[model samples]
Target: MVTKTEETQLDRLENQVDNGGGGAWEYLCLIRKLKVRRSEKVLKHGLSILNDPKKRSSLGSEEWTLYEQVAIAAMDCQSLDVSKDCIRVLQKRFPESKRVGRLEAMLLEAKGSWAEAEKAYSSLLEDNPLDQVVLKRKVAIAKAQGDISGAIDCLNKYLETFMADHDAWRDLAEIYVSLQMYKQAAFCYEELILSQPTVPLYHLAYADVLYTLGGLENLQAAKKYYASTIDLTEGKNTRALLGICLCSSAIGQLAKGRIKDDKESSELQPLAVAALEKDYKQRAPEKLSLLTTALKSLKVSS
Candidate 1:
């Protein structure tokens, strides 16, 4: 039971669709808003119109556009069954559609049908080997299913296919860290740095992975990366600063027995102090709190 205003908006939206002015984004926004307003009747009406191939062909540039609109609307409405049906229909109708298989897999994932989702994604990959989004999703699904090796395999496939993707390298490195494959994670980070030398966060991520791996010999390399991060970012980034402090503190703890009161070992303290001061003045309480904890640890350990 939509209010008059909601009904009027839906009418206007339908007019826009007829006029070829409303796109998938518009339809999705309207559907989401209508759902939030509890205007199920209006949504159902819109979905019916969108699903009507004759009406959809008369209104849109292509029938597949209408299918996408209905599928997205059904997903938004939490109508997983309808969403799956729409995707299946699209898969049959538009076998060559680039997004059909991916959408089907996503629908299956939404329904918590992991095995079916995996099959759908794998089938999609077989059809289109270069679909990076599907590959990334497969990695995430593998990780969620506690199949670390599968995740690694997907990541390796992605790397082999798209060697220059620094972001993918970062993601793969994070996955390696999760699997406690620190050495492999470090190598991934190194590749990421080579691809994107100016990104301080990469260096930080690399250092963090090394810190967790716990061999004192890795400290020098980790500190070098952290130092490069601080230098590249000119000490302005909070994440970079925090990484430097943490790496420095970890290295200091490991070296405490060998070098007492090393000035360079204490360098991280003042940088962390400066970072905290800036965060406090900027009212970034979350960063301030994190830095404060790291600073405290360094103080205790030093």
Candidate 2:
């Protein structure tokens, strides 16, 4: 989701300070800004700064932020001892902090101490029932424990309070999909589309789920969503083009002599075929013939 300029900046981040230079704060901040996860590098560069008393002292109050980043990175890298040390520093400095309590709970989660983690999260929630992180952690615990139903319940409860949470909606949708609950999954995707109408991911997901539902109306709706995805992506998305072909073909066969709208679909199918063929030719010339053979087999009428 970064611009080309931001991508260049990301590529340059590793070379910022000899891989252990004085640019640790800038490097970490840039990674945060980009929302990238270079956990091992984060832990390495973070500790390089933290280990040097002079550099660590230079950060003033920002040192605590680095500690939090390093703690999370340590957990990601499976360096539990490093994570513990960082968390200990934070906990000692701010003993009754809810954020620190979350870090402690996350540590327990990493250690597979589910009951303890749950208890910790539960206690944190007692103070602020709508703690979004803690509530999501409960869902994560359910997922980690392979309790799909429990995860669904926790996500549903979370949604009741935080309906605007796109990630939570997405998580719930995926879990439903895994369980072969396409109808329920479709509902989640609809909410996502409603919340972020311009996001092609939600459109694409909604299309796929609708297609899977396998009805004339659903296929038609799926086709419209697929078309929206293509439009939103400016036709650069190969998957959306492929979805168009699949939906058009399905709709054609199912409506062969049954529907009066065959003429409208007939025009759309050829356009989809042309788009797909052009896409394959430009990106994978050798695959063009293979794609052609496959499209011919679909027999999208007209």
Best by TM-score: 2
Ten contiguous residues minimizing lDDT sum, candidate 1: 34-43
Clashing pairs for model 1 are none
**Candidate No. with top lDDT:** 2
Evaluated at residue 143, the lDDT of candidate 1 is: 80
Query: Could you give candidate 2's per-residue lDDT for residues 184-296 as a string of tens digits?
Result: 99999999999989899899999999999998899999999998998898888888888889998888788886877756665776788888888887889998878878878
How many residue pairs clash in all the candidates, one count each?
0, 0
Across residues 102-162, which tens digit of lDDT does each residue of candidate 1 receive?
7877777767689999998888878777788888888878887888898889789888989
lDDT of 1 at 79: 87
lDDT of model number 2: 0.89
| Model 1, global lDDT | 0.71
